[model samples]
Target: MNRNRAKWLTLMTLVLLTLTMSAQNKQKFKVVLDPGHGGKDTGTNHLKNVEKDIVLAVALEVGKILNKESDIEVFYTRSKDVFVPVKERSVMANEAKGNVFVSIHCNGVASSSPSGTETYVMGLSKNKSNLEVAKQENSVILMEDDYKTQYAGFNPSAPESIIGLMLIQEDYVQQSIDLASRVQDGFTYDLKRKNRGVKQGPFWVLHGAFMPSILIELGFVSNKEEGAYLSSSKGQKELAKSIAQGIISYKNAYYNNGIAHTETNVNEPQANTKSAVKGVTFKIQIAASSRVLALKPQNFKGLSNVTMEKGKKINKYFYSETSDYTEAKQRLAEAKAKGHSSSFIVAYKNGKQIPLEEALK
Candidate 1:
């Protein structure tokens, strides 16, 4: 009887341990890191500096830093110097159910004068420089087989062609912008790199990922000084560390705001009354466009209380604002019912953008 009793207790302990392990796994934050350009693509090249080699090295280093955290899981689109289609990169991130997708690359142009790091979230922009960058990156699709059919006949040279794909990522635009801003802040303050500031552009990879996504232009490789620095191990390590820290900071801030590290928490309403704090204002972001539209009911599905904020590159239209978190959610639902399917709640305080999670607190 004593031996049988001992065996029963051991069995129960083992079962409990298994359950605990499963729960911890579910809490892990999944990140999909994509190193831009590889194999035959080679990306942009200047003298001895190759875009593929530099981005791959930095991406791997960033992955190493994130892997040390027990609660963070990193997935790589490609660890080796192999070509990967831009479309396939996002498909991989979606399949892994990543919480965020970050694609790393280097910028280049005929003139070597431009040098700075810029991060992009998917959106339309009329700025000539922004459109040029988008054109250069989107041109990669032309290399793929039957690109026309795959991309619905998207003309990479024509930045306007990407408008059709805009709605797919509209729901997560604010989150993408939030993550991009953190990355830009890290590059600017920590490394003291040229602060290109966060901007919007239509990139195919950013559009395909279901979660928040950003494409990073590490720096202009065409510039001789920046090119050599990007090629150095020290520069790569520093940049990687900065990128890793930004991701960590974003994860902690959102996680504390009731946004879990798990993939299941995405695409759902972020506002909750339980976490709402005083002085927080919530607004429904209905649409963002390059065209300036009058705040007329006719232009917005006949919805009233419409307002607009013009940014550096785009104009954002909002439905209404309120201090009550629950009421803000009701407005979000109303906007969606009015054909603004991608509308989401954005929070603000003192005219500055704060995380929906932060505002909720």
Candidate 2:
């Protein structure tokens, strides 16, 4: 009787282990693609070059390209010409547990001079043009029912109102910038579009997402030449291909060989001993998630000194802290070696994050 019971227990344990491993193997990288402005919202219409139709077409094409990859799963906020509330788009991405959220849009103005691609990550910026873009996109809240209550009295025209939204994205800002940069690079090198460079703006759609998010302005629809190209099938396909390739590049860098790069490691402390800089602290950001993990070596793959910054919806995890810039780079390399391939050095001065360049100086 004892031998039979032991055999049964062994069989059940092996079966459970196999199931867990299979589930892990089947995990796919999710990409949430949001096609900006649909249904009642025509977006920026310039001489019949409708923004809604163009963005939707391009987004669908991009999703189709990405869906071809076996390891990537794509989700669309709206698959057709339907109105989707701005906030709901983000809620969908969060619910899907998306690795990244991309909102596709087109720029327009009364004047037809500006004609280039601009990719934006959520943040507070003083740039007037960037703020205007945010305001234009955020104005869609007005189309939703009970806009004032839904958005908590967010006034799109008043840029100051967006300052509160910026905090929601603070944890993922670095990752968002990396993704945005890749997208902008694709537009510049692959499509030969004018490089407007990656900029920071308080985009409501991007801020509400827990993961890295970007808002892409494909090009100015107001320009006659650009509008004609954007509306054509050939041009849309080319743009979609570039955008897909950019996402693939980002995924390849961060995801690496079918394994998600976010897995933490518990290893010997990697911060090098070096001379300290006055009023400067450097930390390597390893990961950020909605999960609040205990600061334990066991939790972080045996790494000690792992700290987390808790936020309302997201938390940021970091490894090692030093005042030496060179040591910070060394720590960053160690983190990448430990499988945090997307990790980057974050510098601080007097409790505030500042540019690494300024911190070094």
4-29, model 1: which lDDT tens digit per residue?
Answer: 99999999999999998777656778
- Give the 10-residue window scoring lowest on summed lDDT in candidate 2: 264-273
lDDT of 2 by residue, 1-361 (tens): 9999999999999999999998787788899999999999999999789999999999999999999999999999999999999989999999999989999999999998989998988877766887899999999999998899988888998967865564687667768876887788889988899988788788888878998899999998899999999999998999999999888877865663345554321112235523466889989888765467999877766667899977433467899999876677788878777766667776789987654545544
At residue 226, what lDDT does model 2 achieve?
Answer: 96
Which TM-score value belongs to model 2? 0.75
Q: Candidate 1, after superposition: displacement of residue 330 in Å? A: 5.7
Alpha carbon lDDT of residue 119, candidate 1?
Answer: 93
Name the regions of candidate 2 deviating beyond 4 angstroms: 164-166, 256-259, 263-330, 333-342, 345-361
Clashes of 1: 0
